[model samples]
Target: MNTLALRLFAIWLVVFGSVGISLASEFFSEAEKTIIQSFGPWPPPLIADPSNSVSQNSEAISLGKKLFSERRLSLGRDLACSDCHAPDQFFTDGTALNSAHGRATRNTPGLLNLRWSSWFGWGGAADSLWAQSIRPLLSKEEMKFTGKKLRELFSEDIALTQKVQELFEISVVDQSDEALFVIVGKLLAAYEETLISGLSEFDRFNVALSASDNIGIESYLATAKRGLKIFIGKGRCNLCHFGPTFTNGEFGDIGVTQFITKGRIDKGRYQGIKALQSSPFNLLGEYNDDQQGTSRVRTEHVTLQHRNWGEFKIPSLRNAVKTAPYMHNGSIETLAGVVEFYSNLDEERLHIRGEKILRTLNLTPQEKKDLVAFLRTL
Candidate 1:
């Protein structure tokens, strides 16, 4: 072959080889996508089922909603669930930190689409809603009432006691301490399971996008779409906060606030799991008959790994704008603040192994605004 022809032939061979490799790479990427799509949905739906058996009854729901707002449930007769999770504020009252008789160690997460969660609390302490409701009742900073004193209140208040008794078919006994605690927990759980939240604008927008009605969605509303791109793509939020509920329903060290408050290192999930193990009010306790045997099995057999330290339950993003002071410790105060935290997360402070990838994204100003705007739509 001529020298010029030989050079062209070599160039063609290299180009063809590169193109073949590129085609294989593309095929592998698509295959990965096909495997994921085979699971029926990309972001799996939340507990959107209206016929949730645990909270299907109208009477139970009504009582639960009323009780949710009642402050008298606390020992000080002041801090009800509504004190933190008010209905008007998408169930959260927008506190940087929760306080009642005393300040709480963590933020008050909103109660939106909770019917779908298999676990509750920042540590995944409770396996069911009924079981989850009992935590605040026993906490000194929350309700602060012992099971015995709570029963006394039930006994003294005839109407209150009667309502509870009729609802659960159990009498409030002054002497039987165990029975009183059990009944109180059960009644409250029945109430919480009913505190479901309304659908957000994000859900509708997602539905629109799913149906290929992209033009019908607004450009300003496109901020949320861009945020969604960042979240599931370069933002890397989907590593932990995945699925339609915007949570993997697992634990992680998301670089929240542990060192920010001097001397108040709330050991995150490490101590939380230990506390759950010892807690009598927990689902494995004698009070947890309603969760079937599922609660007992989980509590008794559960094991905690070392990495669980500083790991907290991933809260749903359905009402992200409503619940301020994000994280288990309620350290960050606003949605914008939260975006900023993740954007500029100090890698030196993160406490997990092999966590080199959580470097500061150095998000642009517009990216930050667009991200916050999107979170608000949720």
Candidate 2:
């Protein structure tokens, strides 16, 4: 190859440490550029949760932060939300399924950048963040506390009672079990909403792309660029895990087992729809503070289908490096493992009713490593 062609080729070449990377304006297609640009503009537009009146409230955020670590929410008064969602561990306990208070069926999901998400949890079971917050305290396999227990904790505690009164301008003693329960959930969500991830290396590369800074673009590794081509190209990951937050905020069944026990199945989004529709805490319910009812449409129209049986939320790929044991069940241990799973995906293992979006990528070993290198920048 001539100097011009060689230089251009080297821009896409995989390199090791100390070897500088580069990107040419002509490297990616117009479509690829559009897809790459869609990954960010870091820290997406901050929209307050209408369902939770105290979503952005300062007092609510403070109180919620306290409550997140408060063990009193648990029936045993031993487990706290922070125990499973450790701050240093990126709000995940680093376990496949958290067996803290008890054996949790699904993996403990990261709590960062939750404000951007309309639906919550692996199955998108909770239509609102506050409702999702209440789940840990009520789950039989988790903290396993009841509404009455939660009400008692707040009502009986002198300091908590005062805070509750000050925050809501109402005494906790006067509130019913369900009412107090909702208040705590709202407060927890308020604090949780602020837990956003910072700009990753990928975001910086995106900034370079936007500015047409060839030097700035060079900072992104060459192997990653190859992986990026695959990601937005043949891998078709951007189809689902696209846009800001790196997810479509929809569910997919990527051939993961849904079995909870011998013959017992988790019934992912199918049961999630049923739970959301029946729950009083859903966006359409009375507890929602959205007097305008602006956020109720998604919840109102959600219907259960046989296709949803094995479907789980396509989690945000932001900070994918920190949150380990990937998938709803936390079955994949490493980023490489996750890549491997998709690379050799079993179509037969997929739900019969599930969409035929996924197929075995059959990635070569170098392709796998390159993809992982690209993912780490996120």
Candidate 3:
């Protein structure tokens, strides 16, 4: 070859190699690498709706907070909202199953980012926050307070009753306990709307991402980054648990075999849908219709299906690290164990019905570790 051609080829190779090395170096930089490593690299707005209308008023929230701890609202003045949902333990009592004042049929979920939830309970029965409150109050195992008893208690406590009346902007109907129950439910709903947790390490990472601030996010996104990869890839967790709330908000069978042992089985959303449709405390109830307008979105599209047998409400992962004994039945003990359960999933125990949903994730030990590390950061 000619000397001139050889020289030109050598110069081109040097320039190309230099550019490639520079790009590779930037990609693997300490700060850049660490931020990329953090779990759930997505922004907070992607996880939950920050501007939920339920979080608007302070007075309503305060009133709701006060009523939440008050036992007078219950049947025998024995139970309060705090009985099931405790604040110190991330707003959930952290029990596998919650015993109301007596027996509980299901687990107590953490009230972390409930405003983002479209439905309440394991069955997605209640459509609104106010509607969710009524279930426990009337449940046989829960508060078990009725109309007659509630009215008597409200009448006896003049100051408390007056407070309720003033806060709700309506008087308690003299004879029926239904009106008082509705008021208290609404107040409790208002209070629960204020329990949103502030920005965590995950939130900070999102901020860094928006401004392309690589150095600022590196430290916070450590284990979380590694976990995020496992979650999206081998862990296969992102299929059901996909959004900012770490949930697609769809019901799925997570391989809990409680119903299999029982023989008859708890027909999850199927029964729940019928009960919610016929409920008096529902958003479409006469009480709500009279108080609010008829235009409210209540239990409209909620329906029952065969696949909903073991289905439960998909929970938010805001204070997920603190709220232990995961899932609807609280079957899994720790976050690490929960990840392992999904990793080496035993299909034998899973009653998948007609749908081919829960399958063995086939994750390695290191992959499980990475997934657990990521969950703790949430």
Instruction: Choose the strongest candidate by lDDT.
Output: 2
- State the lDDT at 301 in candidate 3: 53
Candidate 3 all-Cα RMSD: 9.2
The most accurate candidate by TM-score is: 2
In order, what is each prediction's RMSD in angstroms?
A: 11.3, 5.2, 9.2
Q: Give the lDDT of residue 125 in candidate 3.
A: 80
Residue 277, model 1, lDDT: 80
**Error of model 3, residue 31, in angstroms:** 20
What's the C-alpha lDDT at position 298 in model 3? 37
Tens-digit lDDT track of model 2 for 22-138: 236667878889889989899888988988989899989999999999998898899999999999999999999887765878998998998889889888889999999998788
The whole-model lDDT of each prediction reads: 0.65, 0.87, 0.67
lDDT of 3: 0.67
Error of 2 at 160 (Å): 2.2
Per-residue lDDT of candidate 3, residues 252-301 (tens digit): 67666546245656666766677778877676666653334433443555
Q: Write the per-residue lDDT of candidate 1 for residues 1-378, one digit (tens) a residue.
A: 999999997887586756644443343244333322332232344332222233455666666677677776777787787777777886776776665566666777777767667677887776666656767777777787676567667767788777766766665663366566555555555556555555557656555444434333332265665675576567777666666677767667777656536776767667768877876666665655444464366567668887776777878776677677677777777788888888987777773442454667788888988888878876
